[model samples]
Target: MTIRTAFKSMSVAELTRKLASAETASLLLALVEMTGDTAPLDRWGKWIQGPTPINAEFPTAEAEEIRAQVADLLIERGAQTERLSEDSERFRALTAAATDRVIPDAEKPLVLKEMGLLDEAFVDWSAVRPDRADQFPVVIIGAGMSGIATAIHLERMGIPFVVLDKNDEVGGTWLVNTYPGCGVDIASHYFSFSFAPKSDWSRYYAKQPEILAYLKDIVRTFGIGEKIEFRTTVQSVSYEEATQEWVLEIRTGDGPARTMRAKVVVSGVGALSTPSVPELPGRGEFRGKVCHSAEWDPTIDVTGKKVVLVGNGASANQIGPAIAPDVERLTVLQRSPQWVNGVTGYLDSVPEDEKWVLSNIPAYERWFRVRTMLSMNDVMRPAATVDKNWDGPEGTINEANEKLRERLIGYMRSELGERQDLLDQMVPDFPPMMKRMLRDNGWCRMFRRPTVELVTGAASRFTENGIVDEHGREHEADIIIFATGFTAARMLSSYEVVGRDGVSIRDVWGEEDPRAYLGLTVTGFPNLFILYGPNTNIGVGGSIFFQAEAQSTCIARLIRDMIERGASSAEVRQDVFEDYNRRLDQEMETLIWSLPVGTTWYRNSKGRVTANMPWTSADYWNMTRSTSLDDFVVRYHDDERGTAHADDIYRELDSDVARTH
Candidate 1:
C-alpha cells in the first residue's frame, strides 16, 4: 500500500540480490539518505570516477560486496528514518562523492531540482480563486508528450483546459511511428518525465508499445484523459485582440468543423508530427506499397519482400536491422551517414532484480534518475563547440570533437570487423552533433548480412519497379519505406496561427525559420505558448521531455501571473523577442550545426540553425526558471484599467526611451 510499508517487506536476501544489479554509486547515495550514514561513501567513493552511469571503477566482485553491505544497512536502519533531512550541504557532498565530479555552486541548484531533492517554484494556485481561474480557459493542441506534460501542470493548477489531438489516443509521436524497431535512443529513465519516473521500464531503451503505455498510465494517474478530446484536430487558432481571447476552429473525426473560445492557447503539436516525404522525380511511377516511417502501415508484411528504405537516420537505423533477417533484400539508401554512438545494452531488457531495486529502494530511483540526468546533461556539448584556432580534419570541430570522431570510428570498425567497405559508408564527413546523434541498434552489424545492402547515393528517380540512384543504378524493391524524418524546422506547419493584426504565423516564419522568445512566446502572440518550439530541441544533450516540462512551468507561471494581475492578455515585447533571437543566432554561429555540414533537419532552408537550442540544458533551465513581467507588455481588461492597450504601452515606453536618449 504505502511506499515505506512496501519497502520494509523486502527481506535482506531479496534486497541484496536487487542491489547487486543496481548502479553502485546510486545505491551508495541512496543508502546514505536511507540510513543517515556517510560510511558507505567513504568506503566506495574511490570506485566512482566519472559522470557517466558506467563510472564504477570497481571490479564485479567488489561491486557485489558493496551491494551486500548496502542491503544490510538498508534492512537495519532504512525503515526507522524517513529520509534524514533536506540537507543541501549533505546532498551536494553525497552527489559529488557519488558522481566523482565537482558539483559547481552555480549548477548545484539545477542539479538538485532535477534530482527531485529540490522542488521547482510553481504558481500558488490558491492565490487565484477557482472561479477566477475558470475565466482563463486554456486549450492545448496535440495529446502527445509535450501536450500531456502541459495538461498535467494545468490540471495541478486547477485551471480549466482541454487537449485536442487528431489521433484516437495519446502518445503523439510514439503513437504515430509504429514502424518495426521504433524505440527511444536515450536511456529509459532519462527519456521520461522527471516527475513521473517509471521504475519498472522493460528495457534500457524502451520500445514504442511500452513508451505509449507509460504515457497512457500517466494520463490515467493524473486524470488527464477525461479532459482530452481525442480524434479532434485543431484546424486554426486566431487571436481575438478585441476580446483578448483565442478563437479555435476544430474538427472531430470527419465531423463539421466547429468554433471554440479560449483565453490562452498552447501549441504542443511538436516539430516531429509531420513526416517529411521528399518529392522525388516520378514518385507515382513506383508500383509498390510505399510508406513513410511515421505513417507505417502495420498490415503490410515485409517478409520475403525486397524492401528499399530511404534515409538512414535514427528510424532507419532501427528499422533496417529489425527487418534484415525477415526481408528478402534490405537496401538502405543514404544521402549521408549519421554519427552513431554505441550504447552497451541498447537492446537488453531491464533485469527483474534491477527493477526491484528501482521500485522498492527508498532513494534509489531518484538518485538513479539524477545519475542519468548528470551523465547526459550536455556531456557532448564540448564536442559540438567550434574551436577556430586548432586545425584538424574538415569534419572535426575541436580536440574534443576529433576525439569523439576517432572513438566512434573505432566502434564502427569493431562492429564491422574486416568489412572496410561498410565502414567507409558508415562514417560521416561532418562533425559530430551536426545532425542528430543516433544510438547503435545493430546498424553496423546489419550490413554484414548477405541480404542487406547500403547504397551510398540519393534517389534520382523512381522507376515502375524500383528506384534509380544518382549514378542511374536501379535497386529493385517490392516495398519502399521512407525513413526521412519530419518537418522539424517548420514549427506548427500543420495548422494556422493568426496572431496580432491578423498576421499569420506562416507568413512570419515562411517555410521554416521559426523563432520564439525563449522558444515559448512570440512578439505578436498574446496568452499563447509554444512547447517544443523553435530552438528548443536539445541537439547534443538532454531530452525533449526536459524542455517540455521547463516550458510548461514557464507558461503555467505566466498564466498564473495574468490571472493574479487581472490581465486580459500578455504579449512578449518586440524588442525582447528580437534581442533574444539575435543573441540566439550569435550563439548559433559557434555551434557545430552552423558549420557547412551537409543538409540536416536541424538547419532551415535559409542555412540557419533553427531547430536546436544553442545553449546547454542547464542554461535553458535558468533562462526559463521564471518569467520576467518586464519582457512582456501585459494588457489589463477594459474594466480593470480603462482604455489602456498593449500597443499604447509599447509606444509610451518607446517615447520614454527617446526622451532618455
Candidate 2:
C-alpha cells in the first residue's frame, strides 16, 4: 500500500504510536509546522507528556489533508534534494523553518556546510592534479572520529596517507570507555559524522557498543582499516628544515622505536586521550580493585558489592544509575554538584518502522538531522553568553541562564520528590554551560534510592579498603571507580614536537596553556595541522565531529594548495597567530565559560579558557571553509632564500645602521 493509503486506514492509537517514535518526531513536527496547524502540535505536546498520552488523537479537520500533503511533499522534495543550493525552495523553506531565522544569501554556504548539504570537500576534486597526489604524502595521528575523517578526505584527493592510533581499534575514546550505561549524550543522528549519516540507530542516544560498531563499520566500509596501523603510537615529530618533511618517531606495542617521514602531519589526538586521576593521598595504598571510568575493568564483578565512585561528573552520572540497582550499597563522592539537563527521549529506542522511514526516505534523514542539530546545539547557545545588564547571583549568569537554571532545579526537585537533601546536593551554584551540561539519565532518581548515598565533599585519601572524605568520615568499598575526566589542557603534551630552530610546542604553549591559530595550525610548525586542538572544544552547543570535519577540510585545502603551488611548506606568521589568539582571548572574556563563577576543564591552570572555542559551530565552519594564503608565509625548497616581510625579518640592526642620532 502507498504511504497515504496506509496512514488513512491506521487507527488513532497506531498513528499516535508512529508519531511518538523518536525517528518520526521531527518529521511529524515539521509537517505540523508546515501546515501551521495547532491541533497536531497540541497532540504532539500531549505525546511529550509521555506514556499516559501516547494514544493522543489529532483533533483538527485538517489532519487528513495535512498528512497527505506531508506525504506528497516528502516524495517530491526528497527526489530534488540532490545538491547543495540555497535557491532550492524546499531547502530554503526547510532552513528557515528549522532555524526559525532568516538566513541571508551570504550565510548559505556556511549553513550548507553545517547542515551537510553538500559533498565533503573544501576544494573541487578536479583542482587536485593526479601527479602531485603522490608528492603530498600525509600522516594522521589517531584513528578516532577525526582521524578517520581526515584520512577519508585525503584518500578522496588521491593523497597517500597513514593513520596511526595507540589503541588496537578504530574508536579512540569509544574503544577504551566500557563503563556501564556508557553512551553519547548527544542525539545519535547528530553525533555521527555528516558525510556518513546512519539511519538505523538502535537507541536515540546510542550506547558505547553501538557507537564503536558504527565507527568500525565505517572503517571497514571505507577501507580505512587497510590504511590504519593499530597499536602503533606516534612518539614525537620533528621538522627537518632541509627536506621540509616531518620525521616521525613511532613505537609499536613495546617494540623498538622506528622513524618515518611525511610531508604533512595531522594530529587528530583529541583532548580526552589522557585520563585525569585525582591526586588523593595514599591512593596506592588502597587494597582493592582501582580503576578509572575510561579504563573500566570488566573482569571485576560489582554484583552485591559495595562501590565507592569518586567524582560526580558525566561518567559518574551515567555509571551511577546503571549500577545503583545491582550493587548492595553505592556511594557517590562529589567535589561539587553539576547541572543536569533532562531529555525526554533519553531512554527510548528507535522503532523499526521509523528506521525504515529514515533509511528509505531520500532527504528525510538529512532534514530531520538538520532539525535535531539545531535543537541540540544552536538553541542553548544564547544562554552561554553573559548578559551584563541584568544582575544575578552565582546560580545564574543572565536572564536566559536564569530561566535554564530554574527549569533544571525544578526538574531535580520533582525527581527527588520528598528527598530534599538529595535535591539540595544536586542543585548547582554555578551557572549552566560553565561546565559540561550532563544528561539527567535518572541521576537524581538514583540518589533517592535506599541503596545509594550522595556525599558532597573532597576525597582526602584512600584507606586500606575505602575512600575517606575531608570531614574524617570513611566510606568503605569493594571497588574504587574514579569517574574523574581526562586531562583536557594537555592536548598533545605526551609527545615532543620540534619546529623551526629547535623550538618545541611546549616552549611556545608552555606546559599547560596550549594555543593554536584557528585551533588547527601553529606558528613556526610548518605543515603541522591539528584537530580537536586548544580552544576548539565547543561546550556551549556543538559536536566535535562538526569541528573535526571542518578542520579536516581546511587541512586538506592547505595541502592541496601546497602541492599545486610547488611550495615546500606553509606556516602561520607570528603576527597572525598573535592577532587570532588576542581576539579569541577578548571574545572569551565575555562568554559564560570564562566567568569566575566556577572552574571547568575548558580553562587552563592560569584561569585562561584554552579548550573551548568562543564562536558558534557555524562561525568556526565559516572561518575554516578555506585557507587564506595571506595569513601564512609560504616557503620553497628551490629558492634557497626566504621572502622578506615585516614579520619575517628582525630589523633592529637595520634600524641602528640607519640611525642619524
What is the per-residue lDDT of model 2 for residues 477-586, given as tens digits with 9 covering 90 to 100? Answer: 99999999989998886689998888999888887888999998899899999989989987877677788788888888778766655566889988889999999998
- Compared with the true structure, what per-residue lDDT tens digits does model 1 show for residues 34-101? 66667767777787887566676577777787787776766665633343334555675676775757
* TM-score of each prediction: 0.94, 0.88
> How many clashes (backbone N, Cα, C below 3 Å) per candidate?
0, 0
| Alpha-carbon RMSD, each predicted model | 4.2, 6.9
List clashing residue pairs in candidate 2: none
- Model 1 steric clash pairs: none
| Model 1 residue 13 lDDT score | 80
Worst 10 residues of 1 by lDDT: 652-661
Q: Candidate 2: RMSD over Cα atoms?
A: 6.9
| Best of the candidates, lDDT | 1
